[model samples]
Target chain A: EPEVTQTPSHQVTQMGQEVILRCVPISNHLYFYWYRQILGQKVEFLVSFYNNEISEKSEIFDDQFSVERPDGSNFTLKIRSTKLEDSAMYFCASNLRQGGNQPQHFGDGTRLSIL
Target chain B: AQTVTQSQPEMSVQEAETVTLSCTYDTSESDYYLFWYKQPPSRQMILVIRQEAYKQQNATENRFSVNFQKAAKSFSLKISDSQLGDAAMYFCAYRRSAGNTGKLIFGQGTTLQVKP
Candidate 1:
């Protein structure tokens, strides 16, 4: 089965540096999302992207976060400045339809570590 | 806003036995979706099963099944013939069924241990 794929399985950066996490969603999928999980914490929704725009975002998705669909299959999340608290596992998910009821397929998360 | 709750932080089951994980949610929306996801050591979030709020009958996928109580706002997962491979962190999630928004609200997660 086709699945979402992410690059740079692990990322390490300094506290003030920027980091971009990349994802290649399922080819036919239309909706994409980003979620993060702090170690030993629940997975939290960060943002959702559709039609080349952000559809929804959580309070956790603040000014430092931005998402882009630079190409047909690539969905990238960039953090302008990293903090120790920003270190977590980030997951990329995609669904075939935009409906909330559709099941989303997830990619193995990219573990972000801030020094 | 919707909130999913998984009260159990951890659970263990004997190999080949059965186990059940509990989940509850608070949502005013009449139509919605509930899901169970498994995150193994690899940290890959895998969809285990899902239930639609409109469906009165519970959903079953092979050894995995759900007890969905729409009126009570509860959705629980039951794993039959549990195996060692089933050991993982299980998360319960809720999603609104309307509009173009597809964000998932996930619970804190229950870590399951299958003992041999």
Candidate 2:
């Protein structure tokens, strides 16, 4: 089955440095999202993208965070400056359509480690 | 704001037995969606099953099923004929039906251990 694919299964970055997490959603999917799970914490929604623009975002998705669909197939999340608390597992998900009943398929996830 | 809670942090079930994982959520919307996702040690979030608020019939997928109570804001997952591979972290999630940004609010998660 077609699936969302994320690059760099694991990443290590120093505090105050920038990091970019990339994802290639299913070809036919139009809606994309980014969520993060801190160790031993709930998975929290960070941002959602559609039509090549941000549709919505959470408080956790502050100015430090940005998402882009540079190419038709590539969606990326960039953190301007990493912090220790930014360490977490980042997930990329996508759906064919935007609706409550539509299930969003998720990628394996990228583990981000900030030192 | 919406919230999902999985009271049981960990549960163990013998092979070939049935196990139920509890999930409760708080949502004001009349119509929404509930989902159960399994994350194995590989850390891949896999959709196990999904239930729509408007659908009274419970949703089931193969050995995995969900009991959804809309009025009570509860959705529980039941796994039958469990196997060793069934062990994983289960997460219950919620999303609004209308004006949805495609963002899912997930529960803390429940760890399941299948014993042989």
Candidate 3:
């Protein structure tokens, strides 16, 4: 089965540096999403992307966060300035359809560590 | 807004035995989707099973099955003839049916330990 794939399984960056997490969603998927989980916390939604635009975002997705679909298969999330609290496991997911009833497949998350 | 709750923080079962994890949610929307996701040591989020709120019959996938009580707002996962590979953190999630965003709200996970 086809699955979502994320690059740089682990990322380490300075506190004030910028970081970009990349994902390659399933070829046929139309909707993409980003979620994050603190070490011991629940997975929280960050943003959703469709048609080269952001469809929805959570309060956690603030000014520092931005998502781009630079190419057909590549979807990237960039953080302008990293904070210690921003260290977490970032996951990318995609679904074939628009409805929530459609199940979204996930990639093996990228673990972001801020120094 | 919707919220998913996984009551059991941790559970244990023998290799061949059975185990059940409990989940509950609060949502106003009548139509939605409920999902169970497993995150193993590798941190890969895998979809275990799914249940549509509109379906009255329970959803089952091989050794994994769900007891979905829509009216009671409860969704529980049962693993039969558990294997060591089943040991992982299980998460319960909820998603709305009408929204185009397809965002999922996940509950705090339940850690399942399967002894060999």
Candidate 4:
């Protein structure tokens, strides 16, 4: 089965530095999303992207966070300035449709560690 | 705001027995979708089952089934004849059915341990 793939399984960065998490969603899937899970916390939605634009975002997705589908297959999430609290498992997900009704497939995720 | 709650932090069942994981959600929307996802030790989120809020009948997938009570805002997952492979973290998720961007709100998750 075709699955979502993410790059740099683990990342270690310092506070105030920038980080970019990359994902290549399942081929032929349309909608894409970024979500994070703090240690011992629930998975939180950050933003959703479709048609190369942000369709929706949560409060956690502040100005420091940005998502881009630079090419047909690669979707990326960039945090301009990382904070200690920003360290978490960042997941990339995608679905075939734009609506939330479809089941979203998630990648293994990129673990970000900020010191 | 939409929130999913998994009251049971942990649960265990003997192999070949059955187990049920409880999940409750708070949502104002009339039409939505509910999902159960399982994360094994490998840490891959796999879709176990799904239920559409508008449907009254529960959804079943082999040994896995869901009891979706729309009125009570409850969506519980039942695992029948549980196996050791079923030991994993299960998360309940909710999403609005109408929107183009289907962002899922996930529960804290229930850690299931299947004893052999």
Candidate 5:
């Protein structure tokens, strides 16, 4: 099966610095999403993008967080002025279409360790 | 608001045995979907099985199956003939069927330890 791929499986960034996590969703997928799992915590949704704009976002997705489809294939999440609490495993997911019945495939995830 | 709960923090099964992981959710919307995702040591969330609330019949994939009780808001995953590869952290998730945002609400997760 075609899978979503993420770059820099492990990222270590200093506090107050900007870090970008990148993902290449499945080629034909139309919906893309970002989620993060803190150590020993549940996975939480960050944001969803479709038609080149954000469709929905969670409260955790604050002003410091932003997502963009910089090119045709890459989906990126940029965090400005990272905090220690930002250290978590970030996962990118994609679905073929809009229906929630369609399962979203997830990438291997990028482990962001903020110092 | 929707919340998924995995009460059991951990479970264990012997090789060739069967084990069931429990999950429950609180939601007012009747039309929705439930899922089981497995994340091994590698940390990739892999979809194990899915159940649609509208469907009365439970969904089964190979040795994996789900017991979905829409009225009780319960969805559980059963893994049969468990193997070493089955050892992973299992998460139960929920999603609303109505919206275009297919964001998944995940449970805290249950770690499955399989012993040979």
Candidate 6:
């Protein structure tokens, strides 16, 4: 099975610095999404992208957070002026079709630790 | 707002036995989707099983099965003949069947321990 792959399984960044997390969704998948899971907390949706633009985002996805499909395969999440609260495991996911009926495949996840 | 709840923080079962993890959700929308994801010690999120709200029959994947009660808004996962590999943190998630942007709303998770 084709799986979503994330780069830099672990990332340590200083506060107030910018960090970019990269993901390569399954080659044929159409929709892409980003989710955050703070230790001991439920996973929270960050943003969802489709057709090269953001389709939806959660309140947690503030102005400091942005997502882009730099190319046909790469989907990147960039955080500006990171904070301690930003430390969490970030998961990238993709689905072959629209709607919730289709299962979303997940990546191994990137652990972002902020100092 | 839709919220998924996993009341059991942790559960234990002996190898070769059976165990069930509980999950409930608060949602007014009649149509939606439910899923079970397992995060082992390696911390990789793997899909276990999924059930569609519209389907009257429960979803099953080999040893993994779901008991879905749409009216009660309850979805639980049952592991039959459990094995040591089943030990992990299990999460119950919900997604709306309607919208195009299908972001999953997840539960806090339940840690399952299998003793050999």
- All models, DockQ values? 0.80, 0.88, 0.83, 0.77, 0.84, 0.79
Residues A41-106 of candidate 1 have per-residue lDDT tens digits of 999999999999999999999999999999797999999999999999999999988675568999
Model 4 Cα lDDT, one tens digit per residue, A12-94: 99999999999999999999999999988899999999999999999999999999999889999999999999999999999
Q: How well is each residue in A1-115 modelled by candidate 3, as lDDT tens digits? A: 9989998999999999999999999999999999999999999999999999999999999999999999788999999999999999999999998685678899999999999
What local lDDT score does residue B106 receive in model 3, on the 0 to 100 scale? 98
lDDT of 3: 0.94
Q: Residue A10: error of model 2 in Å?
A: 0.5
Candidate 4 local lDDT, B68-114, one digit each (tens): 98889999999999999999999999988885378999999999999
Task: Find the 10 residues in a row with the least total lDDT in model 3 chain A.
Answer: A95-104
Residues A28-72, model 2: lDDT tens digits = 999999999999999999999999899999999999999999979
* Model 5 alpha-carbon drift over 4 Å, by segment: none
Model 4, residue B21: C-alpha shift (Å): 0.2
Candidate 3 wrongly placed segments (more than 4 Å)? none
Which CAPRI level is candidate 6? medium
* TM-score (chain A only) for the predictions, listed in order: 0.97, 0.98, 0.98, 0.97, 0.98, 0.98
lDDT score of residue B6 within candidate 5: 98
Best by DockQ: 2
lDDT of 5 by residue, B1-116 (tens): 99999999999999999999999999999899999999999988999999999999999999999999999999999999999999999999999998649899999999999999
Candidate 6 lDDT over residue span A11-31, tens digit each = 999999999999999999999
Candidate 6 residue spans exceeding 4 A from truth: none
Specify the CAPRI tier of model 5.
high
Off by over 4 Å in 1: none
What local lDDT score does residue B39 receive in model 6, on the 0 to 100 scale? 93
Q: After superposition, how far is residue A107 of candidate 1 from its true place, in Å?
A: 0.5
Using DockQ as the yardstick, the better of models 3 and 6 is 3
Q: After superposition, how far is residue A21 of candidate 4 from its true place, in Å?
A: 0.5
